[model samples]
Target: MFGFLKRKIKEFITGTKKEIEKETKEEKGPGERAIERAEKEIREKTKKEEKEKVEEKPKEKSEKKEAIEEFEEKGKKEKLEEKEEKEAEEKRDGLFTRFKKIFVSKKLGEDDFNNFFDKLELILIENNVALEAIDALRENLRKELVGKEIKRKELEKEIENALKNAISSLLIDSFDLIEKIKTELKEKKPYVIVFFGINGSGKTTTIAKIAYMLKTHNITSVLAAADTFRAASIEQLEKHGKNLGIEVIKQKYGADPAAVAFDAIAHAKAKAIDTVLIDTAGRMHTKTDLLREMEKICRVAKPSLKIFVGEAITGNDAVEQAKAFNETVGIDAIILTKADVDEKGGATISVSHVTKKPILFLGVGQEYGDLKRFNKKEILEKIFD
Candidate 1:
């Protein structure tokens, strides 16, 4: 049957080639009749092929079954001849490959904690962590480590713990929401949160994001466009209000931002809004007039919290900005914006440690819901690990 099939296929190949040649010649000559004849022949040949295939199915299946059984017997023999140690060795190697990046030629040396610390310090420095911060970090790490023998097996976890300890030490303990709310309730009207930051640090956006977060937690806030500079500031705050379904009070460009803040606080108090987020102008902390304007806004609003917005990506400049604002308005806390970018590589730790203000939150993205409560553990894991 195999020989007959081969002979048939060869004949079919030659016949098909001849047919194609004939069709091409016919196209150049008397085309119509020759085309019709070739179509008829093709149909007849296809039918004959179908009939032959039908006749061969039972034989093909029986042959396949015999071949499979022979292979099964061969496999059994091969398995019976295989050494147990060799098979076990291969299985062990595969399991090792699953966990290891590349195979070590010999047994690996023990991973010392100090070595891990060196590499981690390098990583932090490479990511633009300030030299002072690094020195402080190293000092803290040394004190914490002291005489501890952190070994290879506990390397991942020990390093994780070190990071956790270091970050917790650096970050100031921020406000308690329940306690703050109760304190504000004593004041017994609107609870205002005044946002302050340098221009381009996402102060307005951070305010909106915080407001959105508060609403999700069932606390409604009124937005204040206290950013009277920047021709687009009013529009930006208004746009946030429209998108967030919150009430926004604004004034014309270059108008008194403090007046705008006063209006929003008054509105929130009158309407019993639980929280008020006021967006202040993006000004340098050094400019006395601009700093005075921010002070006036805070004075008018009587904000429960003065949130100094800082860019996590700004490296040490964030510390400078925060210190400037702290010197000017006496910031209660800081909101680190663009934390998602910072988590990759930035000086959040240095700023947080130096500023001495607790971080209230982190702006993880541009969306209203992207703000996250600053979790030191999460930040450390993302940064060091």
Candidate 2:
């Protein structure tokens, strides 16, 4: 997972380190050069004065003046040496202190960070990261890295830490779906959850996975074929229900999807079911119509939780979809499908932050056991560790 993004980040870090090191090595300190020039001029002036005095002044007076000149020059040299020694001693306190003076001067300046972040921004954009997320990442990294002291050999690790911290901050925390259901079941008979997403996004499969997951936890659930718009949408859900040994409450095609959801909720109440998983159609091309229909379902079913399911490989598209859904019906959580095949994994990073919702699960494969809970630490490890 995140294979493409991982490789790109590695390349970016290496490239940034090279640029910084090259600039540091090539940089010229005008202060040292000016000091050397001034000292040389002073020495030459003293020597010329001594020569003139030796030629024109009395011998004893010339010698006395020469001795005084030599003593003053020695004092000046000693002062310069003492200043350099003290500065060196201060810098030599620790390896980090020494490298701080060596690597990019005192600290990473805004200009240096901006130059390197431009490369990181391009990598993120190419990998389908959303603009808002990229902006947040830039700010977070700038806060952590810009004006910060770092060692030369640890540059890559420093960048990784900042990137990881920024990415972690972007993702909202996920809640355990099972634990939530168990808690809600104490107050209600069935916890109703409606799944929303565009067509061909594996919404039906994800519902089945959720139901299977609930079953394994000894939480009985019934599938609601609320997607009556498509021709075979009901059958698709019924097939999953059959396979999982769960019941499907459905109506004929062209039926009101909201009515289907209401019936499923009623069924769960009648049969003492633990949860109700409602499936909806993906008529995203007509977003207005889709939202109106989803709103009706929400009104009729009064679902406890609304989940926006999306394809992980869709990247920014998934984020936009989740944003639209949340704006319309306010999604409670998210589930990203086909995550196992996602190389860039931009959606995994962008969706939650875009919608301000936690991602509950990642559908990793086709099997019932393929549903993996979303974990922030695991994501960081996979990308960087």
Candidate 3:
């Protein structure tokens, strides 16, 4: 809408510039000298009359001063009231005002909203949104949704789509999907993947999501429980394996995770797995022993791709995690989880640019089906729009 206003203003300015050019042309002609002489004679006559009036009546000057003071006081009051009104309007109708008004006027039902949020929340949380971010998103969404707004007959899903587009513009980067496909195909066979992140950062969950995604694309994946630290870790990977109907190579807790990784790769080579997704323990990037363990696993896996997963609700901590993991293991891609909570949606760009990694997917929700391919351009368009 503003674009239209901007273009109109630009045209008006252009027209004004052309008129000024015409005026300049006229001023350069012979008539301009005559006009200047007439203007000077008129100014002198007006100046003499004003001087005579001032000299004749001192009372007139005092009355005029009193009137000017009253006018100034009235002007000041109006200005103050105008400023207050503007602030109030901005508070309600500022950013997403149009959408809010439409929602409220329509009187959207709670059930209608529930169904709408179900899909949206799943989509957002799976993308690694912070909890607060998601809360902020819901607040904004509800404000625009519950109020009367610009009339449109589009159904709920269409509105949801538009909302998603609006939010996506604030979330991801310009992902060159075609180029990425070509590059992935260049490897020509097995696209091995090594997943890394401190324990509890959703590394294992991310691996499962990617494997499931590949399966949907008709590609096969082999699971490798390279995280040999925690007892539940291997069991967790095994559960994912069972759910996905795949095998998980593993070793005893406190065993060499690097050896487990080597074996996983060997199994993939022997069984001819199309892809290998190695899951490592959730460990702080700052922990040396944990970091060394992750390093060793990557060295042994010799995987074609390394992905770093992080919790989105941790704010800038996710970016910090991305950087540390990238520095330690040379992460090639990122997978952000809990995106349903992305408040500012601010971390997406800073994290990507900081780690210099292409975000592959967003864990928008807790369900395995909630994972989605990252769309970068969609995100950039929303922020600072």
lDDT of each: 0.68, 0.86, 0.64
The weakest ten consecutive residues by lDDT in model 1 span 101-110
lDDT of 1 by residue, 155-214 (tens): 335545665686568766666654576567677767878888888899888878877767
lDDT ranking, best first: 2, 1, 3
Q: How far out, in Å, is residue 149 in model 2? A: 1.5
Q: Write the per-residue lDDT of candidate 3 for residues 301-332, one digit (tens) a residue.
A: 77777888876656568877888788777888
Each model's TM-score? Answer: 0.64, 0.82, 0.54
Best by TM-score: 2
lDDT by residue (129-216, candidate 2, tens digit) is 9999999999999999988877667777888899999999999989988888899999988899999999989899999999998888
Cα lDDT over the full model 1: 0.68
Please report the candidate that would top lDDT against the real structure. 2
Off by over 4 Å in 3: 1-189, 381-385
In model 3, the Cα lDDT at residue 378 comes to 41
Q: Which regions of candidate 2 fall more than 4 Å away from where they truly are?
A: 28-106
